[model samples]
Target: MRAFLRVAAPLLVLSAPAFGQGGPSPALIGRGRILATAADCVACHTVEGQPAFAGGKAIATPFGTIHAPNITPDRETGIGAWSDAEFLRALHDGVGRAGEQLYPAFPYVQYTRLSDADVLAIKAYLFSLPPVRRTAPANDMLFPFGYRPLLRVWKWINFTPGRFAPEPGRGGEYNRGRYLAEALGHCNECHTPRTLTQGLDMSRNLAGGIVEGWQAFNITPDPVSGIGRWSREDIVTYLSSGRLPGRAVAGGPMGEVVGHSLRFLPREDLSAIAAYLEGQKPLRNPGDTAPRSGYGRPDPDRLSFSLGGNGLPTGRGLYVAACASCHGLDGRGTASVPGRPGFPGLVGNSALGAARADNAVLAIIHGVPARGGRGESFMPAFGAASRIGNALDDAQIALVANYVRAQFGNAAGSPVDATSVRRLRLENGGRSPLVVGVWAGMALIAGLAILFAARLVRRRARGNGAERMP
Candidate 1:
């Protein structure tokens, strides 16, 4: 549900310094707009309060930061100058107009499956936008990754450029869903784990993955650790509205996906996506015993208070003062005023009941915004940077989160600590240790190669000296 769309619609990496030609019909442009929305192109290509598709947003990865390039149809700074063939090559071959290899951050590997007509239609839509004369900043990448030539090797082993083919026996609806999920949606890019070369790990596709410090939980149909219990309606409801009441609510990057992309999609497309996801092979995370939303109940004690203070308040006191107003003393939420959906109940909320407390902690720190089709649902921030009067420090936020989980979620084990809070605050989420280890191993190999060369030079020098002496 996260980690999508900056390099969407191919951004048509320009090869030559020439402007686009001819005018496209309104129908074609409209179709392109739908495709672009499906791809969530605006999320990555547009910065907040900036011209859409002007593209200076920074995408973070373990390797470094990649700024989404200017995709607005400005001849000098954007893709306005790209030819149709150049646009096609960029999307299908992961190559820039100048024949430079594009980083996988643009997602051409998945896009390579797009039909030629679909690719061109997106281009037509982009060309229709008013040209923004803006340029994207240079990428700030690590030593090895900055060298674009290395992408050739990465793509060779991991990429297979081709159009999607429908299954012979399956009906058109199933194939349509497959096309939307695999080609247009590219859900696996975030939900699926990655291989050593940072490519999608297809063997355990959609089992689960992490992005930007938040876990994009398993979408497979496993009874445990995945969405086995989520009916097709539940999936569609969550996708379209960003909440399933007592189940899950969208937060972090998932919230962005809902607000920017999925909400705008047609109901049928949402249903199709749900169908495709439900049909995926069930894969389980090792320790999960029940559904994430099945734990916790209404608190028995409604009226209780403690401050534990030497000028410091207890978690219960904080919750009572700030949280209990909207979410009741028993943790059942109240209705909102007019146009908005009111505060969500903490009990039976997936964020609280999940094995990892990352989402719950993040919600307390950053606050949730109005997203999906759910009304103007909103929460205020309580982190260090928050301007609100009720803002909490790392230690305080930890206390509140732990208290909520214990009292309502029944998730009784290791508690969320302040150190973990600080790390998440720094935007350093859980990256795969295995990937880090691989990089370290490569560095060790390079060092050994250098040592061997030095030893050989010394041995030859000594042999020549001995021969001269004799």
Candidate 2:
């Protein structure tokens, strides 16, 4: 703790310029509020019943789980006493107030590009809030992830890439819009696809990716596959209201985003986001439509459960006894979560995409939450609070895993056995919290900003040619 204080004390002295420039008045606070609207910082940083900005929210990932830390004014546990300079380091340099490296999950890569003034305005607003004395919960990670220092290595590879900004020749609104979407907002945290190393796949910028167990549909302008069908007006309506009359409704994590953050943004900002998004390169088929093996769209009433000697018997028995109550006998999932057209039938649902069974294996091993667009908050996490509590052992877990694979028709072609499940359980034992997601509503706004930019450029060139024709 003494070391931490040493790291932070120097920073406390340097940041007075940024935070104090705004006069710390209510009017300045209002300006900061406008900047805050662009960033959507509160959604991930604050939890309900908790002081605003005093983090401790949980988020899930493919590897394990992670928790956001406290950013409040508590001198001991939170950043309460942090200086403006220190706060800037945390945002732009991925360093904490105490000079320790912060995890990339905090999105410093995106924040690094923020204009100095904008960062200061945000800092002023945050400092103005009433200090909340709350400490953040610890994150639960496996071996390397548990070691926070290792994050520096991840930054070495990924963070070295660069920050987001528009080309020099771009329009002012487009550039400002880019700053709002990429820098402060860090929208890529959910929208951009990731590489196997878990780094953001910048090549596919905003093409859409899966997050929190739901398919984050592509917002690109691909006519057949993306949201190219929606007009700019259609885009603003959805982001501001969380629903369009005929297009779609928000589901999963998106509902929370619209509920908490996007709605508060200025109408102009919404339009800019919409314009920028619509202008992105259109993907041919931008969705996770791959079906799991062995099962085609199953007819609930006439579905067959024959194993054909390919599945594990032990797992089949376990499912009948344990999961059938809520998930249904044929895995049709009853009326409770009738599920989406392409997503129903766990035996064949695409999340069980590959036949390897690791994904499905883990879900049954540990309870998967609010998956496949079924937003019921009914299911409970079983990691730390299971009745049997890791009782299945390895072989049993593997058998159950294999049973699901064969039963669900996953074609990854790898066999899951009790051995695999035991290994995963042991490996994941130290991990923290499960995940959950939202109500009925559609999320987003349409912005064909890029496409419009291209058209404007073409028009300008044509006019120049006409003038030169004399």
Write the residue-wise lDDT of candidate 1 on 1-470 in tens digits: 22112212233322222233546776667667888888788988999899999999988776667899888899999999999999999988999989999988788878888877778878888999999999899998654667788688788889999987776776555666677778877888888888866789999899877777677888999987788998889999898878888888888888888888888777777786787787789998777888788888887777877669586678877888878887888888877888656878888888887887888888888888787344676777778465568568889898888888887784673588898788676553323344445665664664578679889999999999999994
Candidate whose TM-score is highest: 1
Candidate 1 to native Cα RMSD, angstroms: 6.1
Please write out the lDDT profile of model 2 over residues 1-470, one tens digit for every residue.
11211111112212334534546756445556666655667767888677888888875554445777776556776776787788878888899866777777677888887655556767777777777777777776543456567567578778853444465765645555566667756777677787755688888877666665444555667654456777888888878755553244444456566766677666777776777677578765534233222243332433333343647445656666555555566665545334522223455443344435544555554554332233543333333447644445567666656665565555445786665555455434422233111100100111245357779999999999999996
Candidates in order, TM-scores: namely 0.86, 0.59
Candidate 1, TM-score vs. the true structure? 0.86
Each prediction's whole-model lDDT (CA): 0.79, 0.58
Candidate 1 residue spans exceeding 4 A from truth: 1-22, 309-311, 372-375, 428-470
Name the regions of candidate 2 deviating beyond 4 angstroms.
1-23, 161-165, 286-470
